[model samples]
Target: MDAVADHGGSLGRASALFPQAPLPWIDLSTGINPHSYPLFDLPATAFSRLPEPARERTLAEVAAATYGAPSAANVVSAPGTQILLPRVAAAVKPGRALVLGPTYAEHARACAIAGHTVAEVRDFDALFSADIAIVVNPNNPDGRVARRRDLLELADKMRSKGGLLVVDEAFMEVGPLDERMDGDVGRGGLVVLRSFGKFFGLAGVRLGFAIAAESLAARIHGELGPWAVAGPALEYGIKALGDDAWQQAMRERLAADAARLDALFADSGVEVGGGTSLFRYVKLPDAPALFETLGQQGILIRNFIWDETALRVGLPGSEAEWRRLEQALAAWATRRQERAMEAQP
Candidate 1:
């Protein structure tokens, strides 16, 4: 991971790095929703305040309800999970933090930056022995949700070791809200982080929440400065969260799209890991070339250079976009097959 190199998708500097024949690229780099919540055009005054107390209360309440963290006192708001992640690391400052690997990049980054000894638990085998566990429910990239009973048992085992279990539930909203990790939430050393921007499609607002045991919550709140969330975001998030109908529709639509995308990519000889409705991680032989090829076709998707063999494609704009992707992928697969033949005697 170069410090200043663009990795993939729309903003990747790879386009600028090879500008001779610039491709019209579509970005699937981020797992964020392509369709956004209806913005009401917030008032200028809404952002003028450093912190609007009333707005904070409302946003917290709505977030609590949305995340099933009905106990308001345990919730702390931040601009985004990215911001809260490092903050949680700093607050906990554990001697050792165990993070489930092949998941979000930010989790490892957060712990490393905080100077905590970090260990990656690769799978259930490792997780069974992992003393302190941090995981993303409905894990990122793969969208693999751990069995509820297994995860709860793991959390208990970790707690008994005097360790913390942090679960990032950012994409859990893609499924039924009830499927959230509400179990064992208030247990000592158990922290759950959620992002409002994902399911609500309000990334620009940069809103996220931290739920923990009361003592831990107070510690994190005290460490993070006052008025952490801006007034406008606070107001907007509350309204968006209150719209249960919208969230439900978004889930149903994404489920349909995920199914459609799985079928489309299957035609390209790619297998989708996990059960995500927002994005599908397609396993391919050469991700970098596949990414560039897709860019040349005006299709943008996420490819991790380090992985170099997995492409995470997001939901297409419409059925037309899906068709476009499917067609381009089919052609690419033909070319790949031709190349494979060429490599043969």
Candidate 2:
């Protein structure tokens, strides 16, 4: 397997690489929510002055309630989970790190950057052997969810060795509630990372949270310093987190969209691996070729270097985007058939 890219959502890179492909690219390369949360006009102070500590407190309170965290003190807000990954790794002394893999590449990268000897392991039992272990629940690109019981058990084992279990629940909002470990933050060395942007479709807001015991949360908070969250992010995050109705509706919408995407892939003769509502993972020998084909048509989906057969397709926001994707998939099917015919003996 080749080295995986650090992250996705590079529209500029796509445009530069495929300049002649098309204009107004339809990006399905990330798991970010297609239908973003509605925004409203912000108060002048949201930009002119520093964010009020009271507003930041309200944001944490809302986040704690929204994520079912133990308490507001246990929830430390950050600009985004990506920034906190390394911060969390740094807070803990450098030690053996095992990142459950073929998942997000950042966990291992962060750990290694923090000066830990990092290894990507496929087995859950590897958790017992490391000082810090990271698992992306509803695992990225593939959405393989580890059982809550298994996670708790592993956390307990790691705790006995004075280790930490970092569970990245970036997509868990679209998954089952029982699979979440946020409420277990203070128990047996568990830390939960939640992304506000992925579920809310406001990636540019740059907001995320770390739910842990107060001591560890304080360590992360201190490292981040004051004003870790932006003024507008604090304002918007409070509203979005408290809006239970919108969250519920968005969940239903994402579920339907995911099912529709799955059916579309199946109809186009693509074999889908497991996935959550945010994205579907397709495993095909021609994934790289398909990725290029889709890019040529200005349809950008995520392709993996770690596994050449894997492609991650996110939901299209509007009807026109859906039709565009459908047409592109049909074109791919037609081209595949032509290749098959040419190879026939």
Scored by Cα lDDT, where does model 2 land? 0.89
Listed in order, each prediction's TM-score against the native is 0.89, 0.97
- Cα lDDT, model 2, residue 256: 95
As a whole number from 0 to 100, the lDDT of residue 69 in candidate 1 is 81
Model 2 residue pairs with clashes: none
RMSD of model 2 against the true structure: 1.9
State the displacement of the C-alpha of residue 218, model 1, in Å, after optimal TM-score superposition. 1.8
**Candidate 1 TM-score to native:** 0.89
The 10-residue segment of model 1 with minimum total lDDT is: 1-10
- In the range 1-345, model 1's lDDT, one tens digit per residue, is 223233334455646544543444555667788788888977787877577677777777777787788477778888888788877776554567677867777777777777777777777646645445678888877777776667777778767876667788988888545556654578675788988877777788988899987787778877777888888888788888999998888888888888988887778777777547888877766777787787777676776645878777788766667767888889988998899999999
The numbered model that scores best in lDDT is 2
Tens digits of per-residue lDDT for model 2, 32-117: 99999998999999999988888888998999998899889999999999899988877668999998888888888888888899
